[model samples]
Target: MQQKIAVLGPGSWGTALAKSLVENGHDVRLWSHKEEPVQEINNKHTNEAYLKGIELPKELKATSNMAEAVADVDAVLFVVPTKAIRSVAKQLVAVLETKPVIIHASKGFEQETHKRISEILEEEIPSEKRQNVVVLSGPSHAEELAVRDITTVTAACEDLEQAKYVQDLFMNDYFRIYTNTDVLGVETGAALKNIIALGSGAIHGLGFGDNAKAALMTRGLAEISRLGVAMGADPLTFIGLSGVGDLIVTCTSVHSRNWRAGDLLGKGHNLDEILENMGMIVEGVSTTKAAYELAQDLNVDMPITETIYNVIYKGQDVKEAVRQLMLREGRSE
Candidate 1:
């Protein structure tokens, strides 16, 4: 059953998802602020700016106007970064018609406010207007998905029926979707894995072998689980595709911007420098601050995240951060 779908935010991941939906036979429309990317997708059937070399379907349409995109859409999938969700939602105030079930593909919690994307949507989109809100997350790399890889994920929402509906939209031969009731765990798992990916990149930058990177990834999952469970996230969800599965993919895959950003930062580059050099939005940088603060507030021991925060924010040395973690009071795992 193909439904009219509007994917808000035309970043790489957003565009990739648009491609997937179009291929899956949905009436897909993409809206981006930038004209070049949209024009590229519209005129040439390729998103050269983002997913270079991969040609999108001619059926997929691109527009700069939100009014045109959201008109009678079945679902409004939010794919923008955490920092931009509120502002974008505010902009959608005039254009949104029925608040078609929001399926947020971006991962990460908001800074200071400590709100998830679902929370932000609930507050922004009115109750009467809202459709089912679902979060689709897992170890999915947009680059891989654009090429039609077998990517599996969890569609989670407070409402079970809502999760199943969203699963119906994105699930296909190449793209598989599972349903989970723990939206907090699914969202947290998606958000938190990037932090570990950063740690992996830091080790990679320092010329460390697989063993060091492996340690960071595993222990990183532990820290994420501790805080996520404390916050009412399902403990088992952390072990699923959105948890350990995502950690493995993001940490090792060069396609992940989070790990790549950390790689540059680990090699003596600052946050500003890394962003400028990478020329992309690395969600981990902001989420690192949020998670660091979250750990402090919740009294959760997230040593790996704390170390990355120090390296990125407090101008601490990466080697020193590693040494401190190594020398920490040892206990049984």
Candidate 2:
């Protein structure tokens, strides 16, 4: 069945999802904050800044007007950054005439509140105007998905029927969707894995071979699972797509902004320089701070996350941090 879907955000992920929806035969309206990208997507069918070489579906229309985008849409996919979720949700409240299946593809926490993206959405968007929220996350990257690479992700919602509806809406030959009821586990895994990806990039940037990278990834997963369990998430979810799956892809892929930023840091560039150079949100940077705070509050011993926090926020040298990490007291795995 064909439906009208509005993709809020014209970033790489948003554009790729819009393209997928268009391929699935839905009417897609991609919303961009800026006029230039909106005009480019509308007139030229491409988003050069995010997806440089890929061409968007010409049928994927874009607009800057919030009212027009949400008007009568069957579903609204929030693809914006975590920091922007509250503001966007407020905007949606103003224009949304009917309750739509609200789905978010963003993967990060609110730095100020240390709340997950779904939590922020629920807090900002009134329950009367929005249905139960769904989170779409996993190992998929925008660049790979835009080119129709085989990708799998999970759709998590408290409501199984709603999750299955989303599963049917997005499932295709190139993109596979799995449904889960563990929203807490899925969202926590999605947010925390970016920190591990940053660590992975740093390991590679420091000229460490696969052995070191593998160690970091393994240890990183352990700590992530620890934190997730403390926060009421399923322990097994850490081994699943949103957990180890996302950690592997984001840490290893050049398409990951977090890993790229960490790579730059490993190569001796500062965080400010990295952010300026990339011109895109390296979610792990902010997420590192939030996760660090959460770990401290929860009394979770996340040494890797602590090291990343110090390296990024405390002006600690990457090499020195790694040395300190290696010198820590041994523990049984």
181: Cα error in model 1, Å: 0.7
Q: Once model 1 is optimally superposed onto the true structure by TM-score, how far is the C-alpha of residue 290 displaced, in angstroms?
A: 0.6
For model 1, how does the per-residue alpha-carbon lDDT over 1-333 read when each residue is reduced to its tens digit?
989898987888898899989888899999887788778889999887678788889999998888898898888899987888998888776788865888899898898898989999889988777686899999888888998989999999989998998888888899999999999998899999988888898898888998998888889999999999989898999999989988899999899988998787678777787888776778888888999998899999998899989888898999899999899998999
Among all candidates shown, the one with the greatest TM-score: 2
Relative to the unseen true structure, what is the Cα RMSD of model 2?
0.7
Off by over 4 Å in 2: none
Name every residue pair that clashes in candidate 1: none
> CA lDDT of 267 in candidate 1?
81
Residue 196's lDDT in candidate 2: 91
Worst lDDT run of 10 residues, candidate 1, spans: 90-99
Cα deviation in Å at residue 105, candidate 1?
0.3
User: All candidates' lDDT scores?
Assistant: 0.88, 0.93
Error in Å for residue 208 of model 2: 0.5
On lDDT, the leading prediction is 2
